[model samples]
Target chain A: MIDVKSLSKHYGTHHAVDGISFSIGEGEIVGFLGPNGAGKTTTLRVLTCFHPATAGSATVAGYDVFTQSEQVRAQIGYLPESVPMYPEMRVREYLHFRGKLRGMTREQRETSLRGVVERCWLGDVVDRPIGQLSKGFRQRVGLADALLHNPPVLILDEPTVGLDPSQIRETRRLIGELAQQHTVLLSSHILPEVEATCQRIIIINRGRIVASGTPEELRERVAGTSGLIVELKAAWTEIEPALRGLSGVTEVRGTPDGSWTRVALRAAGDQREAVAALAAGRGWPLRELRREIATLEDFFVKIVAGAHEAQTVPVE
Target chain B: MRNTTAIMNRELLSLFCSPVAYIVIAGFLLVTGVLAVFTGSFKPGAPATLRMVFEFTPYALAFIVPAIAMRTISEEYRSGTIEALMTAPVSDAQLVLGKFLASLVFYVIMIATTLVYLMLMMVYGAPDLGASLAAYIGLILVGTMFVALGVLASSLTKNQIVAWMIAAVPLLVFVWFSGWISRAAEGWWREVFRIVNISLHLDQFNRGLIDTEGVVFFLCTAAFFLFLAVKVVESRRWR
Candidate 1:
């Protein structure tokens, strides 16, 4: 539903979104992940026609964002990063204004407003002024405004940022439900939220896409080897050699903790059986033994760190 | 056009919802009323017309109208609502015109409230109805020009106080200091400033003379600033 081709947004000499190309299929929930100042918001703004690209092009719902901004705007529902709202207006009144801006008729707006108010769990605060509502409620109001017209494409920037745990969960569930009918491109600096909510993730750093894939795919690609953490009531010198001698064990490192020692084993394949046998043979007390799979957080850190290092390295 | 009305309606709703509109209106009425009744001695056998009200309105509106118009676009920029509003299915022209109309409506209502002064004159003495109407028309035209200029100023800055000063400085020069500057010059330089003098153009309307030149001057002034306001807003997409 959205296609960005070599999109570059520059503020004078600095490119906020630099030659980043990505697309979202219809009805797909794509999480846009990046640390702060990673051009996530800039990309969304370019797609929404809020800001024109300095170079390259973007199209939404088959309409060019630059040339046919109104059509592109009509098809996309955008909830800006800041959740911009009129604090003096009531929740319903604010949504009503947004609905009208979306060109919804009176009856159409009323019906859509009812649906979003319920979907966003804004029923209780619908009558209250936005300034009086809590941050979570205000965030929900921003979401409700975006969903008021039922646009086919939803562009939400940091949708669940200020929400409490329960509200975050509910927002995740709502986005998951929304993916059934609408294509969603949401950005969040929080990785776990994206892992829990998005079907696919596109990670950007320094105005470029550093990685893109499913969470599991990213984990596998960035994670080189499977490993195990073993704690035994033995010295580091005693445990390291025994694990190193085991089959399929590539490397072994140990840390001494007085009477107990912790051994971390990196292996080419499943070496848990061999380590367990070695522990049994030694007649040493085994406190804890657990296999470790590289998590999405680890992969994200490695990828982002690599990108940051690449930029900082001076060229000849 | 529908989107324009929607924006205008929302802007009007926003204006009335806040205390700023009422406060500005009350302040405007007080200034104009006091200037008319006390300073000008506008009473029975003393012209007994809205001349004093019209005479001081341009000066009053120069300060007060900018105060009202200062927040129209600057507040959107400050609050980040400009992103939300710009992302909507509306043209830049529509947004500018919508805001212009909202400010115009507010000015009309504020200026309209002074009609009671006219009613009081009708009760106490015979006032020149034609000149009174002409003066009001002039005030509306001048008010339109100021609001447009103020909206343009607001579009340029995210700070409301800065927007107020940006617009107020030019207006202050035109209302209070233009003729003084013109008198300091000689020959065509004096004539040039005289032609651009806001008060000179407004006085024609106050004397019940509907000069096409004066009407066109104010209309062009309003149209030019409004066009500049639209350009200023649309320029954001580039930056």
Candidate 2:
């Protein structure tokens, strides 16, 4: 439903987004993952037609964002990062106003208002003024406003930023449900939220897309080998030599408590059985021995850190 | 057009839902009433009428209309609501025009409250009915032009105080320099100054003269500022 080609945004000398290209299918839930100042918001703003790209083109639902912005706007719903709202307005009234602004008739707006209020779980406070609500409720109200027009695509920037853990989980569930009907492009700096909610992930760093794939694919691509951490009730002098003597053991580091040592086993496949047998042979009590598989967080940190280091490296 | 109406309705409703509309109306009436009573002794033998109310409205509007319009677009920009509004399926022209019309309506309501001065003139003295009506019409035309200028000023910055200052500066120039130019210059320069002088043009209407030139001046002023407001909003999209 969205196609961005050579999309770039420059504020004078600073390039906020640089030549990034990506596309998302009709009902797919795609997560845009990046750290702060990673150009996620800039990319989303370009796609939403809030700001024009400096040197690229983007289309949404077959409408060019630069030339046919009205059509593009009609086809997509955007919830900006800050979720700007008129605090004096009631929840229902604000949604109704937003629906009308999106070209819905009064009858249509009324019907959609009911649906959004229920979907965003804003029934209890729909009549209260927005200024009085807590931050979590305000975020829900922003989501409700975005959903009121029932556009085919939804672009939400940090939809779960300030919510408590329960609210975050609830928002993730709601986004998952939304994906069944609407194409979603969810942008966030939080790794686990995107992993739990999105089917596909696009990692951006320093105004570029460093990686894009399914969560499992990214884990496999960025994570070269599986590591087994064997914590033993022995001194580093004894445990380090024993683990390094094994075939798959690559490195070992002592835990802070000094009561145990953690060993990293580097292998293409599972080496749990090999490590377990070695522990059994040694007669050393193994407090914990678990394989350390890389998660989305690990992949994100590695990619972002690598990008930062690459940018800081001096050339000859 | 549909978007404009939707935005206009929302803006008008918001104005009423808050205390802004009421406070503006009350403030305009109270100021006009007190000025008329205090200045009545210096009337220079002019007939008792709404002429006094019309004569002082431009001065009151130089300050009051900016307060009403200072936040029209500036607050939206500062609070990031402009992102939501501009990203909707509406053109910049529609958004600017909708906001301009909404502020114009509020200006009219504020001007409308000064009708009490007219009622008082009718009850207390034989005021010139024709001059009074002409002056009321002039007041509204001048107020609409000022309000449009305020909207354009508000569109130029995200700071409401800055917008208020920008709106007030030109009105201040018109107030302070128009008389100076009329006295210092002769013939053509004085004519040009009078033509561009908003308050000077307003004097013709307050004197019961329905000059078409004065009417056109007020309308052209409003249109020019509105066009500038639309341009300002469009520039933001590119930046």
Predicted model with the maximum DockQ: 1
Candidate 1 lDDT over A83-182, as tens digits, reads 8898888888888888888888999988998899899999899999999988899899999888888899999999998999998999999999999989
Deviation of model 2 at B50, angstroms: 2.1
List candidate 2 stretches off by more than 4 Å.
Answer: A230-262, A272-289, A309-316, B41-46, B185-191
lDDT, candidate 2, B198-233, per-residue tens: 778889998999889989999998999999999999
lDDT over C-alpha atoms for residue A272 of model 1: 77
Error at B226, model 1, angstroms: 1.0
Question: Clashing residue pairs in candidate 1, if any?
Answer: none
**TM-score for all models, in order of appearance:** 0.93, 0.91
Lowest lDDT 10-residue stretch of candidate 1 chain A: A307-316
State candidate 2's TM-score. Answer: 0.91
lDDT of 2 by residue, A247-272 (tens): 75665666645766665556666778
Residue A109 of model 2, lDDT score: 90
Q: Which digits, one per residue and each the tens of the lDDT, describe model 1 over residues B1-239?
A: 88788888888988998899999989988988888767564654687777766776788778998998999999999999999999989899999899989999999999999998888878888888998889889888889899999999999999999999999999998888888989998999888788778998898888887878888888898999999999999998887
